[model samples]
Target: MTQIDRTMSLVRRAVDERISQAIAERRDEWSDAGPAAAELLDAAADLLGGGKRMRAVLAAIALSATADSARREDVLSGRACAGLGAALELYQASALIHDDVIDGALTRRGLPAAHRRFATAHRGSHWLGDAEAHGRSAAILLGDLLLSAAGSELGAALAQCPQGTRAAGRAAFDAMAEEVALGQYLDVRTESLPLPDEGADHAAAGRAMEEAALAVVRRKSARYSVMHPLLIGALLGGLPPHGEGARRLAELGEATGIAFQLRDDELGVFGDPARTGKPAGDDLREGKRTVLLALAWQRCDAGGRAILRRVLANTRADPAEIAAAAAIIEECGARAAHEERIDEHAERARRALEALITAEAGLSRSATADLASVISLLTDRSA
Candidate 1:
């Protein structure tokens, strides 16, 4: 098997084991608490059971690529890489839990969202007086618990690393967490505020909003999703701090991370509800100020502008209005523009790979190919 394949396999196994352990621990802690605890455990398990494992895979690949062949076997066998992968995966879980709460989403990964599921079960059994309130409370606590667990795992992983390597990895991980939170703040702020004045040229205001949205996407979704995890792995593998390989990874990471967020935005607008586990045009429903929306709003004239304002103002717009909004977005050529951006980002990522191959003599050709393949797979995914 290729190095990347081996790394991904190992990382998946590690994440699965950690998730199982977490569930067992949670169950044990609340064993006497009755069904609520059990429900929470089940909810967490459902979320953990299936995911792309992209972040964990990236971590493993980064570490494996930098380690010497002889030491690579030892690192993979020693549990250090697994610990790191598991920690990163847990962090992802925490983020998802919180994201569901923020979005008020009802489902994820084809299952009822953690909060909704817990709330419904509580209400059904007459266990809680206020089902919705109880659900939200439970989800918040559960998300916090998961975040703490992730920190513990990450600490263990760092302790296992060789002396000098831990510092860099920890620093990168910390920055990633902080940046994502800030980005989320920006996103929430944008939604809570009104759009800029229509009198000030609707297109100009829309363009400004798109810029703001992209900034958030870069910090919140891109950095933490792919770049930081990969960098952490590279650091743990004891690669030189500023070597050609390290530089290449950074360049490639930025490109792939941006592309990943763009794809998610596309999915938000157009993905199947059944497959995406989200409502159709959910971003529109949320009034999320994405590039797609910005472009569409910009291109509309007075009538189109009026239609957009009315649909967006309604918290419970009908399907026809939603469809009209989507149509206006498409008619404005925003969809094509966003797609073109995705392609541009993908090309940049590929260029980074090419730069790595050209500049670094020590990097294995197979490793480079594997990295490129994984990037392509992620960037080109439909769901």
Candidate 2:
């Protein structure tokens, strides 16, 4: 494995241990509540157990990017960074739990989604008014529990840093929560709007669609997933958002995040089920208004545009229509355009990382190089 891989592996081990600690404490704290409480904690653990732990690693990268003269070892082992990786993982788990319910996704990472699992359990117990409703309600509460858990752990992480640094990091975390909630609402609003007529003001509608799609990425994932994590890590490392090295990290984070989500948008429509652990054309079937689809609709002929609209309008699309939609996406070259955008963002992130190497940040040469590799792995991922 590469050096970054090895380091992340070790970091993952640490983070997992911290996660276990969070679970254990919660389990005890809620012990008086009943067995149902245990189930919620278990659900959170199940969701947290898997994945690449990319957010945690990105946070680590930001923490390490401060001046080489800073005490690297002390920072890594200190409270400011401690439990942070696990905290991020928990926060993500909470988001996914709610996301699965919102999207009506059946599975996550090859397992039944949390609500589905809870519904199954409710059905098996034979004590529910509506098993599915029960499951959804439980999952919502479970998501709330996870948010609280993540916040608690984050508070602990901040406590280990200086007061100024702690305050700044906490602010970033708070802003992240607010932005993601608002972004999700925006996404819901956009999805509910009527489809525009291709014959009337097609150019203007297409432009508006593209703008809306990019806005989703910007607010929902770019800042929430990548930028805030970097800012929080940098703050913990003793630099505010405008601090030395912070701007570069922020720029790199935004670019990497945009590329990352764009890659996901591609995979949602084109990824292999076995590799991605999800059904083929899942996003297409769900009528996700991705930038890819918007661009495809923009360039396709009238007949092709009709097909696109027909498939998207049918949320219960069968395999044949899903296949047809995928074909249309490719034939219109929307996939290529989306990929080109990914390449652009990836290059931007690469340049940002490279510039940081010789910049005034004074990051250790080894840490700087490892960060470059990390950026590559993040943007170039397939599954």
Candidate 3:
């Protein structure tokens, strides 16, 4: 197998093993809690099972890139990589679960969303009042459970490393957790805020909207998705998390991650449901205040703006209305503008990657190449 495929395979195996262990432990501990509890654990397992494992792979690459040659193989094959990969996967699963609940998403990865699954089960069994409410509550608790498990696993993972590594890992972990939470809150708050007036200074209003949206992208997705993962791995690989090497990784990761999220925003509006596993225009229905939307609002005419305002956040919007909104976005060149922004971030990440390579910061050739591949995939992917 190619190095990238091998790395992905290793991380996937580690994550699967860790999740299975978690499920078994929970099952045994709650044996007396009945079948309902087992089902809950099963649901968590199901949600945790599917993902690109992109974060875990990034961590491994960072570790491989920085570790001493003699120790590299041992560490990559040992508990540190395994534990870190698993922890990152679990953490991502938790975030996705909570995010789906917040968005009131009905499906995830082509399957019913956690809340929707629970609601369906509730209705099927004809148990309890307010099936929808029960589903949301259950999904929230499930997300919390996974979040707790992630911390515990991460702590256990770092305990086997050196004292300095442990400290660095914990610090990065804590910072990432806090930042993402703040980002999510900001995103929710942005949804309630009024859109900029159409007659307002167009450039100034566009900048404001873009800045606010980028804030959400940076904290909510970028750092969480890339920077912290790379930092954690660098720490475990014996690079000081605050040192020059770590700083370079952070810069590259953040740039790559920003591109990744901007591409995600584009996909939400323009991607095929068959590939994305969500319906077309799902973001419009959910009224995601994305950079793409902000730019489109700035360029659209009054009628087009009215159409967007009416369709956004209106979950009941029909397909035709969604088509109208999407067409407006395309015709106004917002989609193209969004793509240009993604390209800009991608180029920034490329420059950072080149700088790191030129500095000869001890990254292995294979790992550096792998990092390059990941950056491309993240920014240019269709789904």
Candidate 4:
């Protein structure tokens, strides 16, 4: 197998093992609950079952690239690195559980959301007060549980690392968790704020909102998703803090994260339900004030502006309204603008990788190429 393929295989195996271990641990702890606990376990298992494993893949590759070849004698010896990836995945699950509650989403990955599933089970079992409240409350607790589990798991993984490498990994994991929460807060706050008024200083409001959204994206998605994971891997691999390879990885990660988020935004708006596992135009319905939306609003004319407002105001927008919103966005050139932004980020990421290879003779060209390929795949993905 090619290096990328081999790396991905290792990552997948590591993730599977971690998830399986997580399930077994939870099962052992909750065994007395029997079938109900089994159901919850199943829910938890389902939650962790499938994903792109992008963060995990990045972590493994980053460690492999920077670690001394002698140290990486075995793939599983990189458990600390894989643990970082598992932490990210668990963090994603926690965020999604809470997000489903906040957004009132019914399904995720073609299954009822955690809250809904818990609530339904609670109702059937007759062990609760209000079923809905029970479900929401339970989901909240479960999210917390998952987050805690992620941390504990990360600690376990880090424990296997040499003493010199453990601190750096811990620092990265801490920053990732903290930053993602702050970003999520910004996003929830943005939803409540009114859009810019007609005759209002459109430029000011649009810029302000866009900046806020961008900041949120940076913290909530980009930094945690790509930058920190890669950083942790490099650190665990014994790359010095100011090493050329480490610095370059940071730059590459930032650009990759931006592109990754932009792709998510695009999927939110344009992705097919079958592929994306989200309803068409879900972002619009959720009134997510994305950078793309802000750009569209800024460029639209008066009539187009009115159409945008109408779409946003409708709580239950039909397909026609969604299409109209999309059309206005396209007509105003926002789609092209968004695409340009994606390209810009992708180029910056490539440049960062180039700089790394140039500055660090120890940096493997094959590893750098693998990262570049991953970035290309992310930027080009449709869903």
By TM-score, the best candidate is 3
Full-model lDDT for every candidate? 0.80, 0.80, 0.85, 0.81
Question: What TM-score would candidate 1 get against the native?
Answer: 0.92
Least well predicted 10-residue stretch by lDDT in candidate 1: 361-370
lDDT of 3 by residue, 225-286 (tens): 98889888877767765567777888999999999999989989899998988899889998
Candidate 1 lDDT score at position 200: 83
After aligning candidate 3 to the native by TM-score, how far in Å is the CA of 50 from where it should be? 0.6
CA deviation > 4 Å runs, candidate 2: 67-79
Reference-based TM-score of each model: 0.92, 0.94, 0.96, 0.93
| lDDT per residue (tens digit) for residues 1-383 in model 4 | 87677667778788878878888988999999888678766877898897778888887777777545555425433576567678778878888899888877777877789999989988888884898998888788888878888888788878876789888878887888888888888888888888888988776777787788788789878888889888887787677867777788888998989888988897888888888887777788888888888888778887887887777635688999898888998888988989998999999999998888888636566577678888888788877
Q: Say what the RMSD of model 4 is.
A: 2.2
**Off by more than 4 A, model 1:** 1-7, 29-36, 68-78, 242-244, 359-362
lDDT comparing candidate 4 with the true structure: 0.81
Worst 10 residues of 3 by lDDT: 68-77
- The candidate, 1 or 4, that scores higher on lDDT is 4
Residue pairs in steric clash, candidate 1? none
Q: What is the per-residue lDDT of model 1 for residues 1-383, given as tens digits with 9 covering 90 to 100?
A: 86667766767877688668867987998899998678767877788888878888788777767556666655654577778877888888888888888878777787888889879978888873899988888998878877888888889888988889998888889998898899888888887888767688776788888888889888888878878887898888776768887788888888899888888888877787767777777777777778777777777777777777777636587888888887877787888888888889889999988997787635545456667987887788778
What is the TM-score (0 to 1) of candidate 4? 0.93
Report clash pairs, candidate 2.
none
Residue 109's C-alpha lDDT in candidate 2? Answer: 91
